[model samples]
Target chain A: MVRWEPGTPERLQRAALELFATRGFEETTAAEIAQSVGLTERTFFRHFADKREALFHGQELFVRAFVAGVEAASPTASPIEVVAAALASAAEFFPDERRSHSRVRQSVIGRNPALQEREVHKMASLAAALADAFRARGVADPAATLAAESGVTVFAVAFVQWLREGEERSLGEIATEVLGELRALTSAV
Target chain B: MVRWEPGTPERLQRAALELFATRGFEETTAAEIAQSVGLTERTFFRHFADKREALFHGQELFVRAFVAGVEAASPTASPIEVVAAALASAAEFFPDERRSHSRVRQSVIGRNPALQEREVHKMASLAAALADAFRARGVADPAATLAAESGVTVFAVAFVQWLREGEERSLGEIATEVLGELRALTSAV
Candidate 1:
């Protein structure tokens, strides 16, 4: 019988990031990552489909956070207001404790072109998902797409700023501030 | 001495598209594309890095159009105005005659996951380039990112609408309408 393993995925993610950082992503093997965490390659495969999946821990949760936030927003709110609420809710996923890990993860993804492409693909998919949520709330075509993309753009810019060295603001604060900047940008028109 | 082949790349591109649409991209070879145009494979490689490059014939020109538009905008214009100017300039590349070819190219890209990733990566790079242009124009921080991304989002949404079957509006018209929609969304804030 397989032994019970609590937090196996989280533990593997930490080990994989550390090893990928030091050894290089292409140079690092799944077996080495598993061995570093005292697990077998089969266990690693069980937790993560592959090496890259380990690097993007909780991606489904991240997507769900945006959708859940959309669902939980006040029904009377405007599309933009609903998007703002959704972003504010998604910010909870990237708490202060997770900032350092996110920074490292971004750095690792930055160094590799394939990883960078995957990151972009994920963001594109996220925008599509957010657009669907907006449409489901009765928002129309171009408006639904615009609100979703705007939400993603604000969140992306804010997340990068939050990752900057010595930035003390939480992700939510940065997102709120960035959302204001977005409004300021539109005001200029 | 090699004979100067006029419209060689354009010929290769047209041939490649026809062949890819019929025979499938994976089944098609460089020699087949080149020979279809009475040129050699070496000539094809000299013009394009690979088969994929044959498909994205004017990507550099497309990118230059955005940057050029940014540079040509009125100096005192607001960030949003500048982005609108930039997109308006870039829209010149997609004339009525190019729409059908674009539809085919997009269909080819839509069918391939790798091509879709490349497309997303290109958009991300375009956003970064636009942000850099905004920064150089004295637009700061989150505002620069917001304007750049908003411009790209508008352009992207407008592009898809323009590509839709039976759609008659020009890309510039669609983009302007979409920008107005974006402004409306923000006005709700």
Candidate 2:
């Protein structure tokens, strides 16, 4: 089994984010982040390549879960259905307990143009991965790309709604509604 | 006439791209870029918020031309037609003689994760604007967003092809091919 970092990468991520949100990303140095977590800057560096990387540590796991969700979904599912299932499965990693941090993370990412771009790139990469997986499963060309891309867009819209709903509902529920809306919208001639 | 930046922006952009292409983005510094154009670091700051902005100054012009092209298109044209025309119009701004810089620019942007994200964000914003424009044109829900977003994707694919084709053929040809490809892709089954 691989050794994980002390106190959890998620904890460090939260600390780094609190620092970034409070002091602004440029002003918050890695040394400061390390100090806040009672660790050396060396330790922080050991975990993350740079300051920006702390924000992205869990992306690989997230991508893997999402792809697995798509692949394991019912064989007879529609293109959007498969994608929605994948997004739904990925939501389990984001617990209701972490919604506050999740919102904060989204806010921080939204306010920073560079961070926003990185997030978009990550989403695009995830969509591409999903498309490739779908193609491997015998889905046709172009449809796979469109379904993957559109599915990502629907997830984005749902995530935004979840944030906007302010704890009134879960991402899974919002995702369901968003997917339904997309289907209705697309199906309406 | 609107105020212009006295050729400083263009010169800095060209110098920065050449340096970025040869030395790589991270290896090149803002000071070297300033020195190449016989300008001071202060002057460089006056023109660009940062070094990365040099590669994206034309993006605003592109958005404007695209919107204008859509607006100038036939009132009764389909949404795809409007979007294609807008992209075609924006293609007019591609420098007739700057194939080398264009290639270098694409390469640099492609290599840098941060740059790629910014490009995606810009495209997203442009796509949103197109949707809004379509809404203003009295098109109903879902169709506006889908058509606009799909058009942007088509434009993106076409733009990549144009860049790959290395300016030998006009963007119109590439865009036409992209539109045909999109139609065939979406229309099947």
Determine which window of 10 residues in candidate 2 chain A has minimal summed lDDT: A180-189
Q: How would you class the docking of model 1?
A: high
What's the true lDDT of residue A45 in model 2? 87
lDDT of 2 by residue, A56-108 (tens): 88898988887888889888876766777887887776667767777888888
lDDT of 2 at B27: 90
Regions of model 1 farther than 4 Å from truth = A1-5, A42-49, B1-7, B39-43
* Tens-digit per-residue lDDT, B1-189, candidate 1: 999765888899999999988888888999999999889999999999888888777777888899788888989999989988988988998998989988998888888776787788888888999899999999898888899999999999999999999999999999999999999899785
Q: Distance from true position, residue A179, model 2, in Å? A: 4.5
What DockQ do you compute for every candidate structure? 0.83, 0.21
Candidate 1 positional error at B92, Å: 0.6
Candidate 1 C-alpha lDDT tens digits along A1-189: 999765989999999999989999999999999999899999999988889889877788999998889989988999989988999889998889988988899999989987888788888989999999999999999999999999999999999999999999999998998998899889774
How big is the positional error of residue B161 in model 2, measured in Å on the Cα after superposition? Answer: 2.1
Candidate 2 on B1-189: residue-level lDDT in tens?
A: 987665878889889989999999889888899998888888988988988888887777888877788788888877767777777887777755755667778999999986887788888889888888888887765557766776677677666667775347776777777666545543433
**Candidate number with greatest lDDT:** 1
Question: Candidate 1, residue B132: CA error in Å?
Answer: 1.1
Quote the positional error of residue A170 for candidate 2 in Å.
4.5
